[model samples]
Target chain A: MPLNADQAHYLFSVMRLAVGARVALFNGRDGEWTAEVVEAAKKAGSLRCLGQAAPQLNPPDLWLIFAPIKKERTDFIVEKAAELGCAKILPVQTEFTNASRIRQDRLQAHALEAAEQCLGTYVPEVSDLQALQALLKGWDPARRILWGDESLVGPAQTLAGLTPGPWAILVGPEGGFSEAERAQLRGLDYVTPVSLGPRILRADTAACAAITLWQSALGDWM
Target chain B: MPLNADQAHYLFSVMRLAVGARVALFNGRDGEWTAEVVEAAKKAGSLRCLGQAAPQLNPPDLWLIFAPIKKERTDFIVEKAAELGCAKILPVQTEFTNASRIRQDRLQAHALEAAEQCLGTYVPEVSDLQALQALLKGWDPARRILWGDESLVGPAQTLAGLTPGPWAILVGPEGGFSEAERAQLRGLDYVTPVSLGPRILRADTAACAAITLWQSALGDWM
Candidate 1:
């Protein structure tokens, strides 16, 4: 198993990991595995795979579609998506999107970092920014969008009640879902309008809340 | 009811909430009630209580106990706790707690801001920093501690499965629960060890996850 230099520094120096120390490794594709350091250096380290520690637990085929916010907040969402086991992350640009574009590579790095920090076995794919219309036009019916919307005018539904399948969560930008975008989403057959609860959760909070709700309802938790 | 400067600015500038707008306010102790903006000032605003719109839905009497992290992350926890319907937020000092000290005033402000943003009637109180032992010493039988711990060595449990009552969620620092702290928690009768899931969530993530789980299991969602 290979670990980047950042991981090496974290394990060797900050965490004081030594040669022969057992470590866990997951490539998002493989299940959690145990590895022992064969060569440990401050800046570099090598680990030989020992055995599979746990069978791969695939995240529910859920994608998180959100309007990219500020740079740091967007980065935060990406990291959290990886930690929470979103299968994919699509940064959508809405009318109120504060950010013009996103650095996909940097976001991907954040996802990797979040995965490493949480000892997660998965890293959700971070896609390039797409216009809301473009994403909606291309959304696959097999994978539906559980829109994390706030303007719904009724009692919120629990994720527990939703049937498990290919699902994704949609969270708007700080300004919230525009009328046109909301109308577009409401018109889509693949989009399920769901509110997290009575309170208005921020985009980041909504993202995490939706993931947990989905996990509790359909993912491994149930 | 009083709206802080930032909230006033938001109401006047951002949302353009005009005078006499019907709003609601809750101070945790009082139930949620409708109110009208009696005075709309750019820097501050006052409201006149109309009546209780929604009778006090006391937060299962849960206390959110978490280690002090960075200012922003800590603030995030406080804000989310208020919106998640936590009654109180206690900043705990643990072995791996890296932050200098908890900013009670700033944190309290965050809670209030969160309440205003979510249109929530109640605000969760931000408590001063207390050592873990000090907190345990004062543990009341009436209030159980729902430890949002990640190291539980068994099948994961859901908050949706729990019966709501007086409870506190203990979120460890970024480094995680100290070995000694875990041992102490496991030995406590009032401590209920619940897992968010198999994934290792950050302290902030764990806080929100636990609250969501608790609400789904036993709060107003019931």
Candidate 2:
């Protein structure tokens, strides 16, 4: 397969890979494959597939739905989510969300980089920013939502009893969910409000913690 | 009480607080107290104690001992550790650790800011960077250490069987612990090697996830 200019530069100049050097590659769908460099140049390169290195290992049917915050923090959420084995990432515009728009391509790139850095075979998809209300209206009730409820910040509410299945964790913006939005979520049977201990966590911290909790309790971590 | 110049600038210039503006204060020892601004200026300020607002809520006796990585990531570990309710933060220089030094004061400030942002009553102390071997030499066996062992990174070894008390979580640097260091740690009776998950996590992500797992299972979250 022919490599892109950026990939060629990375392999030839940055990584100092020469022709015949072997590298692992993944397409987020195909299992990992080892490809040997057939041609190497400053701005162009080609590789021949050696064989499958490892089978594709997709994360559990888990998703992270969070209200976007600042650019750096939003990137952080996507990166950590990918590293922590989130299958999909959705950036939602909550009533109190500060960022009205997000660079979806940038976030998707972050997810890809995070997966590569973490030696992950699968890269989670980063969805474009969407309205939280609209997303919830079309949500599948079969996939439960673990809501990080700020009001319930106290001793940890163990997720031990929860069954393992399709699930998503919802974290609000820095300003938190508005009353109307909270009411709407609380009224939904698919949502389960959970506490993340006594301290009030920031949006990013809460997202990471909530994902860790869910994974260790009911997701792949178990 | 007299406010420092930085605090004054923050209150008067950044926050735009004037006389009679009330703010919550904590000494990391005393309970949270409400103070009314008596004088406010660009470089100086004063306040009068109104009353105690909330009792001091100290986190459980849990410590985070991590090998320092890059500057921003080191800062991140401190901030997340504070927000996650760690009682103390210790930066250890491991055999394969990259950063030779860390600014203790700056990291302490990050912890303080994180505590304030999270509405935490106490700020975790950021200790000066020390050699891992040295710290382990004088280590108290009574306080167990939860080691994020990269070798065991397959399944989530549930922490449910462990008991909580004075405990610490230790995360290695990006290069991970040298084989000698790993051997020494594994030999220690108080060290319990546990896996984070099926994927390799970056240093920052591992720190946050390990803290979350320990907190949710054996720390105050219980």
Leading candidate by TM-score: 2
Query: How many residue pairs in model 2 have overlapping backbones?
Result: 0
Q: Flag clash pairs in model 2.
A: none
Question: What are the per-residue Cα lDDT tens digits for candidate 2 across A84-118?
Answer: 99999999999898788999999999999999988
- Alpha carbon RMSD to native, model 2: 1.3
Interface RMSD, every prediction, one decimal place: 2.2, 0.7
Chain B only: TM-score of model 2:
0.95
The best candidate in terms of DockQ = 2
**C-alpha RMSD between model 1 and the true structure:** 4.5
TM-score, one value per model: 0.82, 0.97
What are the fnat scores of the candidates, in the order listed? 0.50, 0.90
Q: How would you encode candidate 2's per-residue C-alpha lDDT over B62-156 as one tens digit per residue?
A: 99999989888888999999999899999999989877888899999999999888878899999999999999999999999999998887888
Report, for every candidate in turn, its global Cα lDDT versus the true structure: 0.80, 0.92
